[model samples]
Target: MRINVLQHTPNEGPGSIATWAELHGHALFTYHPYQFGQLPTAVETDMLIILGGPMSPNDDLPWIKAERVLIQDLLARDVPMFGACYGAQQITKALGYPVSKAPTKEVGWVPVYRQSSVIPNLPDNLNVLHWHEEMFEIPTEATWLFASAAVRNQGFVLNHRVVGLQFHVEPRQNNVREMVVNDFPYIKGSVLNQTAEDILRVTVSGKNERALFAILDYIIE
Candidate 1:
């Protein structure tokens, strides 16, 4: 299968998703709109993966708008899609849902409770890395999947083909470090926010990879 990824930043690339695709013998392609200002003209791939970024989907940037249009196109085509963080917000906004500021800026490793058993093998509670100030409202047509204490709309699934997660489950140790270094300014001293040292100290475990792969498999199955 041809799996296309829309990466919004250099730091936030498809980490374990690429590994999963390689293991499954699927061709993976990634487009960088932040650097090249280019995106797929149509749904040419079997699946789409949208990675996280520092920007908001509600931003007035031309590329952000274009990306949303592409997402809408994919939705219309019923293309299987997986979006993380800002990517999730983009999907929600494309679905005519509002993306607005959360009650607090949730950062670092936080626990998200599974609200539905739609994706098998997911634990009831999982601690995932989060670094988003904005939250996506669950679309009326979508099923709510997960929620965190700081954000109620942590995840949602639409038509059993599209999954949107508001946390970073695909980030490797190096990816997290690079994100901390590049987007460190966004971190503030809040109850939910974590210090750079603390966030880096925690090891990236296999549980995250398993959950991410499970979600990917569920979407494409």
Candidate 2:
């Protein structure tokens, strides 16, 4: 399968998704919307993986508008899509759903609970990176898949084809540390409420990455 990746930044590129794509023999391609690029003309892709970003879904960015249309068209055509954080918000918003500031910004490794779905076949609580200020509404046509203790709407699936996850299931440790160094400035005001030491403790739980990829693999399958 050819998996197209819509990247929002350089560091938060593909992470485990790239790993999985390579190991599984799926051809990988990328579109950096931050650079105002076009979606691939190739339709050979079996899945579309939209990565996370620092920008909110409501941002007036040009790529945001273009990708919104692209995602909607993909969904309409019944193509498989899996979005993370901002990507998930974009999916929900494109479907006429709403996204807004979450009361508590989930930052470190937090457990996401499975709702009424086959996801319960996995662990009861899998720790994930929560780095978004905005949350998405479960599309009226979608079914809730998972939730976290801090946030109720962690993820949802529409017609079992499109899946959106609010948490970062595939975070690379170095990229996260770098994010804390560079992108941290933008989230500093609200993120500072939690100590850097505490964030480190939770995020460094390396075992979470396995479960994260497992979930992603399951979702894509």
Candidate 3:
């Protein structure tokens, strides 16, 4: 299988997604528009993984606009897609859905609930990493999968292939640390936000990793 990852920032890279691809011996490619400022051509991707970033999909940035175009092309072909935080926002915008600022920011280890879906036996509550101030509505033709106290549209699946999550189920300790350092100012005092110390204390357990892999398996298989 071929997996193409679109990463918008230096700190935010494929975490468990890369691990799963390597273990499965699938071909993996990445395009960092922040550094290179060039998007990849829409090729035949068995799975398209869009990693999270701090940027908003509604930004006036040229690359963000270009990414929406690519996302539209992939949707038209019915290619399986997995989008993280910012990636989720992009997917929603591409589908003509609204992407707007949340009433409160969601950072650190937050909890999410899985809605009843084909993916079976998901726990009632899941603690996953989060670092976003924006939120997206579930797109048309997509089934709502997850929700949180702060955001109702935490995750959704479109055509049973394209999945988007507003939180991070893939980031390891290193990834979280990098995000805390690079985007420290976002860690303001809030009911939903947590301190750096609290964020570091949150463990990357096997449960969350397994949930992420389960989603990936569903997407690629």
- The model with the greatest lDDT is 1
| Candidate 2 global TM-score | 0.88
* Most accurate candidate by TM-score: 1
lDDT of 2 by residue, 103-211 (tens): 6777765678777655434566666777877899998888887898667899887876788889887767776676666665555545436545556555445555665
Predictions in order: lDDT:
0.89, 0.76, 0.85
Model 1 lDDT tens row, 1-221:
99989998888999999999999999998999988998876647689899998888878999999988988888888889999999999999999889998888888998899999988999888878998888999999899999998789999999989999999999888988998888777778555757888888889888889999999999988
**Winner on TM-score (2 vs 3):** 3
Which residue pairs show backbone clashes in model 2? none
Steric collisions counted per model? 0, 0, 0
lDDT of 3 by residue, 29-105 (tens): 89898678877677866678888987788889988998889899998887889999999889999999989988777
Clashing pairs in 1: none
Using lDDT, rank the candidates from best to worst: 1, 3, 2
Q: Candidate 1: misplaced stretches above 4 Å?
A: none
Instruction: Give the backbone clash total of model 3.
Output: 0
Could you tell which candidate, 1 or 2, scores higher by lDDT? Answer: 1
In candidate 3, how many Å is residue 44 off?
4.2
| Stretches of candidate 2 exceeding 4 Å from the true structure | 42-44, 187-192, 203-207
